[model samples]
Target: MRDDSTRNTIIFVVCSLALLLLYQVFILEPAAQRRQAEAARKPAAASNTTAGPVAGTLPGVAAPAQVRVVTRQEAAAASPRVTIDTPALQGSISLKGARFDDLFLKQYRETVDPNSPPVELLRPEGARHAWFAEFGWTGANVPGLPNANTLWTVTQGSTLTPTAPLSLQYVSPAGLTFTRQIAIDARFMFTVTDTVANTGAAPVSLAPYASVQRQGAPAHVGHSQIVHEGAIGWLGDELRLIKYSKWAKDGGMELPSRGGWTGITDMYWLAALIPSQSENVRGAFRVTKAGETNIFEANYVGALRQIPVGKQVTETTRFFAGAKTVPVLKGYEKQFDVPNLNWAVDWGRLRLLTQPIFSFLEFIYRHVGNFGLAILGLTVVVRLLFFPLANKQYESMTKMKKLQPQMEELRARFKEDPAKQQQEIMALYQREKVNPIAGCLPLLLQIPVFFALYKVLSVTIEMRHAPFMGWIKDLSARDPTTIWNLFGLIPWNPASTPLIGQILDTTLHLGVLPLAYGFTMWLTTAMSPPVGDPMQQRIFKLMPLLFMFIMAPFAVGLLIYWTWSNVLTILQQYVIMRRLKVDNPVDQFIARFTGKSRAA
Candidate 1:
């Protein structure tokens, strides 16, 4: 004769914990190892492909060339350059091939340190990772057509600025004049206008092409599930996101579309080639090998344009090379009609919910000036939104707690027959107007919202390097304070230890925030009805610790949000239990501490 209402809850918690552990050990860890092994095998600066030859070439066409290994500084200085100076960007364009290379984001740094180097988005050819955008004209074996190796003469400005655009000109041996006028905006978009004049006796058929090429894998490849790092683009209204390993395995992808954008995107940075909205274009995400080096290219080529003798044709395209901020992307989507450009943020399947959540969180952050506080405020908002439902669930839980004694009596009376016990229990519940399963509704409703917040926080660059209270410098990263070194008070790094260092760093590096979250979770569990079975109770008792360990690797922002949410829920539950006059652990704890009677 035992009350078993909490038995189901214990079983559910235990099973969920087991499944999470199994998934982590069997799926995530192994995949991470494989990626690590693969990354170790691939060397840097192998090779790359191009979108066009000089000014007009077919998409995915590879030009025969060897890039001498050189330092990034040396490669950037190897040729004459056009300085790109903007509030958001600082770099130099290579005049050698009229390539948008040697670009750095002025707004973002390589690390949290203020003096850290700015994020280098585009590197010059021959550098360790040569990633840049190039635009030119390509004709069918037409002599003197601009090719990848063609050196262009600066016909206009010394620098490409938002106010003063620069123009480069290349005259083909076949008497065709290719002029490229490149202009930058206040933000990331770059407008390139390619004009081809047919000075030859015959008409010249040419195509305008642009490409974003990566000579090698990035030094630090991200294996995060939430962030997309590789070739990503929208083709003819279809969004394509291909991982680097998958792209290499599948060779490449090609699609024909009237208008779309193609590019290589990292978690925060993007380098995309947007074709003219008025012209039909072909988009290709290709990975080819030049000798032992693997080349990755995302490019678009507009339909061929005929420039009759003494006539000229102009093809204007756009390039986006900068941070993939939500506002910037959405602005581009609206202003330029870049199809599905907002999808560049990798909002996942819950974009409907995640987008709004992100916007709201961003709105709060703009006012609060601290992302961590914004997350805390967001948790409060979500709790308030679901407060009524949660109150009903907690009230039901209180009724169940009150019915425990009566249920036990009924179970003991019907101990001889299990079916009778279950029936009597159901009838008693119906008589009391209490439903055991009603308590689960609030949790079920929270799953999606919780996941949406996780996605928003993890993928948004705004959360990157966001600081909370002391020792929590980066909200997007795991807690840096480790108990292994007494939370940095010992003046020693746990990572510097030998042998079991990594293991300790992973499992024993409990931070203050996570500890607080664990305590709150434990308190919440303690306030709930106690389980009857010994094993069930033991498993339930261990859930808080187990969950704390599991969530230790999660981002600090997520932990803060969860911890704040738990506090709010605890307060709500306590208030409900008090109103219901139910015997709750919180009341009992306070009574015992104050030496008062443990009575509601």
Candidate 2:
């Protein structure tokens, strides 16, 4: 029976590893290559198709026929644009439709390369994958109320900057004058104050509406589950996120929100429409199909106000278009009363653990000037925090190691009497005052912390292009140096190898860091007492190798933290074993390496 159980355990482990390899080769690698290929195939010029008819657009509105496919430069130059220059933003607001379609984040870049272009937040309407924020007034029984197609005239500012706000004006033939004041802060928030003056005799009822619309889906959609990449909103104090696929399947969804915001979010960038806190609004996440394109929109409309014959009322709405940095989001949440704006970070259900871990990591990184070092420091802090519990657990393990001889004897003596062997083992344990489960306590406790750190590393933009020691340019990415190509020393690309290229490069391409992790894990396992069953001991011996393969594709920062943690655990166990005078693998390893007796 024991032999059969051991065989089954080995079989299960082998099958799991096989399935993992298959999944990486057949699913993950293929999907990644396909997405990259698609991005590469996209033309620089916008397609003949238009990304028009966004939110606040009238039903049955027809897109223009000429299908103006132009470059971003042509799109920006085709219409007069107001320059948007700020510490955090650089772009132009198109005067044609008063749309913030040409915007770029000044801080972040497309790559770590200094010459790479800054991150483009919003692109021109006629450019590929066009995205922008458009706000307008929708009035009942009122025509020509400045819809998306309406061209507005810039009134005051030549340039929109943090210190200066731009004003735009549009006068309807019916005698109502619409004025828009666009103001931006030092960070990512943009506040638009719209005022409509009733110059005509008749009163006009208008509902202030805003929408953040993205044409088609992202080039690389459904890329991450850890970070939200679709329609997100906070309505009625409840935060919501709907993926692009979900939106397409569900058609549309709406929630009544008072004083909240809704928008489209990328992995690190966001464009949200914030309605006034006092105004009751209806938020909707809608999808519209035009030909082969799907237009995604997050829009909200405030309560309609009746503008009297000679009186004008003002309505204020906010727009956020920038990186989803922690400080900026929190600042906006506090200053503008944006509800649950931090949800933009996608903290997951473990926000309680993830938030603190992220804060601690960021705090350490600021002082250390290295994100990789910060992760190492964070691991040390975590280890110290759990030192007391781990000490007790290691001490118990030491005691168990001391009883190995007696346990072996009992097993031999009760070879035919299994029940008596169990009884003897329990008696021996009670005599030694060793809890059999103590070794598992620290591991169980670290699971949540491990997942929290993973969440932090996966979602935070600060770690996106962070670097570590030699050969590690981006800690957020997998180790680029793989042993299969002699750590990139050889003039060979494992990924370009025919047939099994991706599978070999992704799974079997061992990195220096992963090898270090495996070694530390092996040492930590070696210091522990061997299992009573020889087969079980053999299976346990393979755990380090199995885990090294499993974690090979994980982020380098996580691998660094985990490897450091293993080293710390081994050191702690060594100390406990030495103090308790228990036989351990550390002494043997040291003596073997030094060619001297451990006592000497």
Q: What RMSD, rounded to one decimal, does every model reach? A: 3.0, 3.3
Worst 10 residues of 2 by lDDT: 58-67
Give per-residue CA lDDT, model 2, range 120-150, as digits (tens): 9898766667788887777666866776567
lDDT of 1 by residue, 416-528 (tens): 99889888888887898876777777787887897788788778888888888887889998888877888878987777777587668865568888898899999888877
Which ranges in model 2 have alpha carbons more than 4 Å from their true place?
1-52, 55-70, 496-498
Lowest lDDT sum, 10 consecutive residues, model 1, at 47-56
lDDT of 1 at 300: 81
Highest-scoring model, TM-score: 1
lDDT of the candidates, in the order given: 0.80, 0.81
